[model samples]
Target: MIAPAPGISLGIDIGGTFTDLVLHDPALRRSGSLKILTTHADPVQGILEGTRRLLGEASVEPGEITRVVHATTLFTNALIERKGALTALITTAGFRDILKIGRERRYELFDLMLRPPAPLMPDALRLEVPERVKADGTVVTPLDLAALDAAADQAVAAGAEAIAILFLHSDLHPAHEEQAARRIAARHPGLSVTASHAIVREMREYERGCTASANAYVAPMAGRYLARLGAELAAMGIAGPLLLTLSNGGMTHVEEAIRAPVQLLESGPAAGALAAAYLAGAQEPRILAFDMGGTTAKLSVVEHGEPEVVFGFEAARQARFIEGSGLPIRISTVDLMEIGAGGGSIARRDAIGLLKVGPDSAGSEPGPACYGRGGLEATVTDANLLLGYLDPSRFAGGRLPLDRRAAQAAMARLAAALGITAEAAAWGIHDVVTEAMASAARTHLAERGRDASGFTLVCTGGGGPVHGYHLARKLGIRRVIVPPEAGVASALGLLTAPPRVDRVATLGRRLLAWRAAELEAAFAALEAEARGVLARGGWAEDAPAPERVVDARCVGQGAHMPVTLPPAPWPTDDAALHAMITEAFTAAYQERFRRPPPAVPIDLVHARIVLRGAARPLALPPARRGWEGPATAHQRQILSGGCSAMADIYSRPGLMPGFSARGPALVEESGSTLVIGGKGRFSVLENGNILVELDA
Candidate 1:
């Protein structure tokens, strides 16, 4: 029985196929988790159903949930489906076509028929106002209030619910943009407005404008959803504050999130990365985090307990793997790579008579054929069910039963297309998806300069653990870790993430001549703004001092490298501090380029700060200890080496710590299981994690 405590922290993550919920009671050091099929039409409905069921099953009241953190792919889906509110873009006069006239370079170098992606807002809705600011924070043409009103009038008259304002050089001087914002707000009180400077304070005009418009495109939709969700949660008697996870894996109150929904993009994958880092611990300093959900699989690298962080990432790319083929979203984000390998991925024969797994998925509405939700397609899940990798009677803890006959029939239809037997088709689908994952992993890891053999694979999400063993084998990894409740690890990550805020400002000064006082003043101003953001999230008072970073580059270089400042309370002497900054930049430069410092002076393009609160203490113990139970095993027919083999299946929850078993074994749990190959040995570890050691 779960004993009542002061309060419970609830973590919820909504993915393409499943919605996972975890309730953690810090006082008792206990957690309860649940996975439910996602409601495609109304995602919140799934949350309501899952939450009520989990609370009741765990014997907890709604009021006991003191903290609520949520992460989802909702915003990403909204962008892809073009389901955002009608939006308009307003820019400085003569720059109405800025979004259309983006960079000259093509993402696909020699593709003859290639065309750049269309702007988020229509041309007719992109209005311009009379305003200008010089490159170095000087006002050239003052804001014309009359022109601004005319632009606002056009946007509102065009039935736009949200508007994005972008003034050239706003990053260096934001006065005109700020003034225009005040005027627009006063005139159009109901329209959601996003200022370019507020979203991205950088030198790139096109990128900054695109980021702002994207935020505005989703702002109204997110605001309505968050408001409605918050009210409903209050009505449900859960009075705690509702927080949303950001792309960088930090929690922020609902109000702050509503203002900038772009920051919440790809947050689900980031949470999964955090969970992997947490589970890896210090012992496994290097690991690959593979989170395979229903729609896609997310892969990330974690080193020394920290997942890699990148300054920005592309979203909803036209060419999925091409960098510049998508909208440039410049925000601090976890560096994660995604592949089209998931349980719901559809399998079909291409025009070339080659079998191909998906970049398209069968979402929960009509999931896999075995789900019995009216789906007719043979998906990965359907193949898994046919291979006996999944139990028909005990799927999702019996809440959702698998229809084995339906799965077999679907596989037969697919096999007919490829001139093969149904059983062969089933294994084909399984192997195809695993190979796709391995192929993508190799490319991503190679780009990051990492070798797969040196890293331990940490698997999460519903599908990761089941296919992880072979996936590891394909990558030449010898060890794999499947944490307790692997299916709900992403949600659990939300419970442990700290509240964090990131701030950035363009410096536009030569570091050699910049005085320490001048730099400190600028950074101080940014820190104050960041603190205000934290204050809005109710964390500023107790949050630690922010970390400092500088985007430094040579005088003739187009791009800058980020260098972090040593520590807080910088040196009082100007010469001493300048020396510290110079030394750090040279060291970072030498490390990346492997050359001596250039003769040219260095330019400081942008300065950044990250303020964060302490994370919740929810790390698992080294082992489940005295709670061990019997590791009784049973026999089951599992597909192996293109044939049926009887494998020893053990109950995961009943297995005690240190329980060891050979390969050709299945470890079953309430939500998911571990499918080990015949070439490895599997064991239950001290912290309730399952460790599989592959044969050399």
Candidate 2:
């Protein structure tokens, strides 16, 4: 093995179909990347193999790598598949059914048989103890130690591998919950335990309980996976500090990740959004990040060089469009909308003989029929193959050769059912999936009071560029930017992430009767907590100053909006502090609602602080100056605009910065392909990103 070089960073992203890896030397301004089919049985196997290949191809030794950052969808998949450990919940005696009762609001009012997601803990495993804590941190009744012991014993007898403890109003008064946790830990040292107050200190009981239950459910599995991965990497002679990306567009150490795996639910997609923001922020202040992989498509908005952040999101929804149909997790995460439209989404005719695309996919194991992996059903990839949009011999960098005949046969079966030619059926499938994605984009934007026409579309992932032009045209977007190595962009994103942690506390105080010292104390405590977390991740020395935000609302309003506040050492006078807070809140409120409300008393609900560590920026390699070789590598017949045309094919790497191509062209690379519509004009930017301008 060649001696390792210093200062090399390795980033790995595990997707549904592929595990992408990127090894870059920031100082050298160079990079090497690889894509391997994911091993469903053991994801670590794919990660190890891809790592070895990437290091060898880049001519660097494992010891030379200084950092390893990873993002995966494994935990999210476990939640959706219901493959987590047997978990039990321990709560106040009368509030045992809080998980099941939920908010009691029907997500869908008209459906005759509406089914909400089942609680992570069933009734049999939900053991309760006699405890009482009021909403104001007052103890209504003392906790019964004997009752708590009995519940612990019952949970153990029921074969629970993990236990979640949620005492009523514990967010404000955590002493009782802490006492119970210590007792349970002492009795069952082998079991994993999670407490509601430790995870989220907000007001809602149901949401906090759900969050704790989810963390306990996935804790055992995530711990084991991280342990095994760490052992394997150590055995491979890699001495780098392993970091895991969080769903909030930040990275944390392996130990912190194991403690709170729920924060990693959308980690992979968040990385993709962050990467888009970094690459396109200079050219466009506002961008719509569209990432289409093998199993799903994700959309997120990036404004002013940062992705929007949301405090809560749902997972494993029974109905994608309906709220409250899935498990609610209250964690800071990048705001994104995900739909089941991707390359491997299955296509079939409905009961009434109407063609439909998926909310289900033929994942990597039996990937689209074109991969010749025993799949017979027609899928989006099969349709793309029949439409001549994908090269059979070059798929997955030639690691997986696609079978054109198999794709044709699969489409033929669907075409027979539709009573149309295979080509027409293929077009129908393509158009259907494209429209599904566009419609979803429109709805997502509308909900934010924004329109798609105002944002530039930045495309990434394997299927993103292939469908970017059509989706852009549908959304009334005129420009699309496809960065270099777009297929592995998320892995590249992992390289750019900074170490960060967010902490929140409930204040629940009225601004009209507030004290400056009390407010300062609350924010200071949150900053200290955030700093400790960042310190554990090896960012203690140069962590950036904490950013503070407070959730405020009209005294009687049920909800609150987040207001960013200036750093600590606030005004010493109470009246001055109140004026500052009210002014900031009013400004933010007016911007959001388009008008200011009448003079009213406001209350502070929660205080939040974010701690970030500086990460070195990646330099873009200089682009080739001229296109000396033949621009047209070959010609292939493709279906577009309801007709077939001979599209000129070009090699993506061979195109220089000033290279330009008209519509009816295909730009091919190792892992992705860019399809230019008949009326689109494509050009290469200085940074090697391809810009395609759509014709209205």
Best by TM-score: 2
Give stretches of model 2 more than 4 Å off: 1-6, 625-629
lDDT of 2 by residue, 242-312 (tens): 88999999988888899888889899889889889888877889899999999899999999989999888
Look at candidate 1 and give me any clashing residue pairs: 623-686, 623-687
Q: Would you list the C-alpha lDDT of every candidate in the order shown?
A: 0.86, 0.88
Writing each residue's lDDT as its tens digit, candidate 1 over 431-481 gives: 989988888888889887789999999999889888999899899999999
lDDT of predicted model 1? 0.86
Segments of candidate 1 deviating more than 4 angstroms: 1-6, 619-633, 641-643
- The per-residue C-alpha lDDT of model 1 at residue 373 equals 90
Lowest lDDT sum, 10 consecutive residues, model 1, at 621-630
